[model samples]
Target: MPRHLLKLSDLAPAEARQIVLRASALKRQADSGYRPFVGKTLAMIFTKNSTRTRVSFEAGMARFGGHALFLAAGATQIGRDEPLRDTAQVLSRMCSAVMIRNDSQRDQEEFAAHSRVPVINGLSDLHHPCQLLADLQTWFEHRGDPRGKVAAWIGDGNNVCHSFIEAATLFGFTLRIAAPAGYQPDAAVMGAAGDAAQLADSPAAAARGADLIVTDTWTSMGQEAEQQKRLQAFAGYQVDAALMQLAKPDAIFLHCLPAHRGEEVAAEVIDGPQSLIYDEAENRLWAQMALLEFLFGIAA
Candidate 1:
C-alpha cells in the first residue's frame, strides 16, 4: 500500500512538521543541484484551472531531476468518462506519483483508493493540503512554531479556510474565521478542530490581536455565477488596511493568490511591507519538493 495525501488530516502532526522543516532546508539548498528524483516521473492531472499548483509541482519535479506529465482532464480519456479507477491504475503503473487538482474530494479519494503510487491532492473542493504546507512553512520562516499563535481568516469559508482549520488542529494554533452566515466553513471540519477554531462576529473581531491574517478571493474559480451575490454578502469582510490595523502591529498578511485587489484585500495591504504573499507563493515550490521527497521515501 502507498501513502496518499487526500487532505491535511491524512498527515500526522509530527509528519507534517517534518515536511515543513525539510522544506525550509530544501529552500536553503535550492541551487545545490541535489536531485533525488532523477529518474522519477510525476503525472499531474488538472480538472480545474491552476497557476501556483501546476507550475510549482512541475518546477519542483524538474528541480529534483524528475519529469512531470501534465494531463488536462478534458484532453484525457478521463474526460470521456474513463473510470477514475482505470486511470489511477494505469498511471500508478508508470508514474512515480500522481497529483490531482479537481472539483470533488470524493473523486480524488476514490482515485487514490485505486492507486498503487502515492496520490497527492493538489487541490479539491473540500481541502487544499499543499497550500497549507507552504502557508505553514512561510509562517515558520517568519514567526517560529505556530503552536499557541493566533491566525485570522476573513472571507468565504472555502477550501483554503477548511485546510486552515485542519492545520490549526495539527499545528496547535487558534484560527478565527469570519464568514457570512451561509458561507461559513463546514461544521465537520470545525468540529474536528475542537477549540482550535472559532467563528468571529466580524472581520474586525477576527483580526483583532491576531499574529497572522489571511483571506482569499470572494469569487473562487467555480463561483463565477455567484460573483455579484458574493460581493454583496462579503461586503464587510475585506482585509483592508483598516481591518489589518486591528491585528498586532507586527502581524503578517497572506493570500493564496491571484488576489482580487479591492475585493478580498486592499492593494496597499497585499503590496505593503507586512505582506508575505510572494514568499508564500515561492515556498510552494520548495514545500512541494519536500513533499515529493517525503512521498517517495527520499533522504532529506
Candidate 2:
C-alpha cells in the first residue's frame, strides 16, 4: 500500500521536493500525451462546493489515464447518512485512493483513521494539503529552488495560512506570517509547524525582505456570516501598493484566488507584474497530479 499524505508535514522536506520534481516530470510526459495510470480508479468526495479542487483532481487523474469518481455529500452517507468510519471502510475496499474535500479537519482525521488505503485531504477548516503542494511546487518552479528564500504570508491567517506555515517549516524556508492583532494563526497549528525561524507579526513587518508574499480572502466560504466582523478585523491588512513596496523589489505576491479585489488584496496587485497568483493556480493541477501519483502508487 502507498503512504497517505494527510498533511503538509506528512512528507519531510526531501520527500516533498521529490514530489515536486516527480510532478514536473509527469507534467512534461502528460503534456506530450503520455498516460501512465491506465486502469486505475480514484474516488473523490466533497462536502464543499469546488472550483479548482474538483477540476484539477479530475483532470489530473484523466491526464494519467485514470478515472475519477466524484461523489457529492448527498450521494454518499458521510455526515448525513452513514458514519464516516463505515464510509471510509467501504470506500477503501472499492477504490485505490480517496481524496476528500470536507468541512472539519476532524472529519479528515476520522476518514484517514479508518481507511486502510491512501486517504488525501482535499481541504478542511484547518488545512489544505493539496494547496501547499502546489504552493511549494510554484516556489520551486519560480526560483528553481526555494532554499534560503524568505517567504511572507500577509493578510488573514486562515486555514490556508496554517497549511502554508507547516509547508514552510517542512521545506525549510524562513516563513513570516503577517496578520492583524486579533487575526494571528492558530497557536496550536503554529506550534505544530515547527519553524524555528517562523515569525508572525504585522504585514509590513513580514513583507520586509521577503521573496514571496501571500494573501487570502479575509472572509472564507463558511464564514460569510462574519463578513462584516472580518472586514473590521482585517481592515488595514490589505496587500496593496504601499505594502508591496515594503518587500524585496523582486518579491512576488501570491493569492490563492477567488480574491476579493479591492479587499483582501488590491486589484492592481493581484493583476500586476509581481503577482504569481495565476501560476500558483496552474500549479494546483501539477501539484495534485504529483500527490495523486504517489497515492496511486505511480512512482512519484
Candidate 3:
C-alpha cells in the first residue's frame, strides 16, 4: 500500500513532473508555517558518508514538523551482521518512512520489499534519484520545460550519470555523456534509455551547443584507491572555461556538490556567474519535501 522511490523510472512521467511542480510550490511557501508531519518520524540509515544527502533530508523532516532518527549502519545491528529484512521490518513498524544510503542496490531493494512504510532511496550504487529530482526542479525553475533541450554530462559516468540517463527518458531531454571508454555508464542502462541518450568521445563534443552542462567528480566515494588512475583517464574531461564555451552562451552549468575545486571542475567555472550549483544544492530540500509529501499522500 506504500509507495517506494527506488529509481526515477519507478514514477510515471506525469507523476515525476507533478513532484517537481510541488517542489516549486513548496519552495515558495517555505516560510509560511507549514508542518505536515507534526506527529510523524522518519528513519535515516546511512552506510556511507554524506553531506548534502544527510543534511537535506534531516532538515527537510524538521521543517515538516517531523522527527528524523539518524542511524549509522556501523552503530546499528545492520553493521553487526543483522539481516536487512529484520532491520527493514523493525524500522517500518516504528517509523513513518525509511531511507537508506548504501552501496548495494540489491540490499536497498530487499529492504524496500519488506518495508511496511514508504521507502526512499537516499543513495545507491545504481542510481541517485533524489539528486536528480532536485536537478530537474532547478532546471524547470530556470528554463521552463526541458523537453527538447540538450543536456551534456561531462565526467565519470557514475550513479549521477545513470540517473541522468533515466531522466532523459522520463523528461524528453537528449542526454549526451562524455566519459573515458572504461568509465562509461552501464550498458543495460544506456540500452534502456535508447535514443534519449548517447555517448560522445570528448567533452567538447558533448557540450557543443548544449543547453545545460553538468559534471561530477572523476572519482567517487569508494574509489579512493583508484584516484590516480581516474585522474589520468579523466585528464582532459574537466569542465573548464573552454568546455563551457562549447555550449550555448547562456547555457547553465551544474555540479552536485562537495566538488573538488580543481578536479572535476575549474575554480572559476563552479564559482562563476553561469553556475547554478548553489541553487541546485539548496533545491535538494524543497524537492525531497515534495517527495515525502507525495509518499505520505498529503495535499498542499
- Best-performing candidate as measured by lDDT: 1
Residues 40-117, candidate 1: write the lDDT tens digits. 999999999999999999999998899999999999999999999999999999999999999999999999999999
Q: Spell out the clash pairs found in candidate 3.
A: none
Backbone collision count in every prediction? Answer: 0, 0, 0
Error of 2 at 208 (Å): 0.7
TM-score for candidate 1: 0.99
Per-residue C-alpha lDDT of model 2 across residues 1-300, encoded as one tens digit per residue: 457777787888877888888777766676677676677778999888899889998988887788899999887776476888999899989887889888888888888888978888888888888888888787777777777788888877777888888877777777898788777888988887666346566778988888888889998888899999999988888999898898889888888778899999889899999988878888889888888776666644
lDDT of 2 at 145: 78
Ranking by TM-score: 1, 3, 2
Give the residue spans of candidate 3 off by over 4 A. Answer: none
- CA lDDT of each prediction against the hidden true structure: 0.95, 0.82, 0.94
Per-residue lDDT over 152-263 for candidate 3, one digit per residue giving the tens place of the 0 to 100 score:
9999889999999999999999999999989999999999999999999789999999999999988888999999999999999999999999999989999998899899
Q: Clashing pairs in model 1? A: none
Q: In model 1, which regions exceed 4 Å deviation? A: none
- Model 2 spans with C-alpha error above 4 angstroms: 194-197
